[model samples]
Target: MTKALKASGFLGLATMMAVGLHQFVILSGGNPVPPWMIGGHAHLGVLSILAIVMGFAVPALGVTGQLRTAVTVLYIAGQWGIPGIVWLGEGFGLTFLMPTGFLWGLALIASMLIMFYVTITGDGDAGDRGPTATAPADD
Candidate 1:
């Protein structure tokens, strides 16, 4: 899962860079930036960074096995799907794709909720922080 997340992160970064350069070219040509391009560029860059961070944090959060697999898949799908759909829908003026993109975003949010639940409930011992340092010492 970690490798998958990191691979996705790097891939996303590469893709985002290409988009960014495309945006630069558009601006350099004195053409107004398309709204879809701006949206795609921002989402791709931010989500790519989140993917990299989640790669490290997931393990520390003790998410493992099948559940981890599910989360990873959902995260990757949302990370790319949302913006990709935006590019398709807005760039090509096919607004029908917006609902599908919204679904993708919801999936991403669901995965986040699962992570939050796991963290608060302490579902695994992998990330046990042990006793709090602020606890009063025995007399």
Candidate 2:
């Protein structure tokens, strides 16, 4: 793997595991997530998976600004879309106590905005210089 790939790989692995753990937490049926992560388990679970996928794209975004922007759009969509849907669908759920689903939705919206910036400006292994940029330099 190239230096960029190697450097970013740890973040990728962490994100992937984090996503996978989020799923596991949800699937665990109140084991790890407690009462909060229940009910809308799918929403949180999907978000983590999206985060992991986004992490993979982070490295490729090292070159071209356009590809990174595209990744950002997708990231924002996935990040907020699922949570927003869940919050709207189950605003009355117990897990949505206190700040509630609306709060989560708001946070997700904010995150999407931040993601747009990160995707466009952040350097990643995803190689903004087109497909070849992602490929190993020695290859």
Q: Which residue pairs show backbone clashes in model 1? A: none
Which digits, one per residue and each the tens of the lDDT, describe model 2 over residues 29-100? 765544323434445455655565555555543424564454445445545445444545455453434445
**TM-score, one value per model:** 0.86, 0.36
- Model 1, stretches more than 4 Å misplaced? 123-125, 128-139
Worst 10 residues of 1 by lDDT: 127-136
lDDT, candidate 1, residue 44?
A: 86
**Cα deviation of 4 in candidate 1 (Å)?**
1.1
Look at candidate 2 and tell me the lDDT of residue 28: 77
Clashes in each model (backbone N, CA, C under 3 Å)? 0, 11
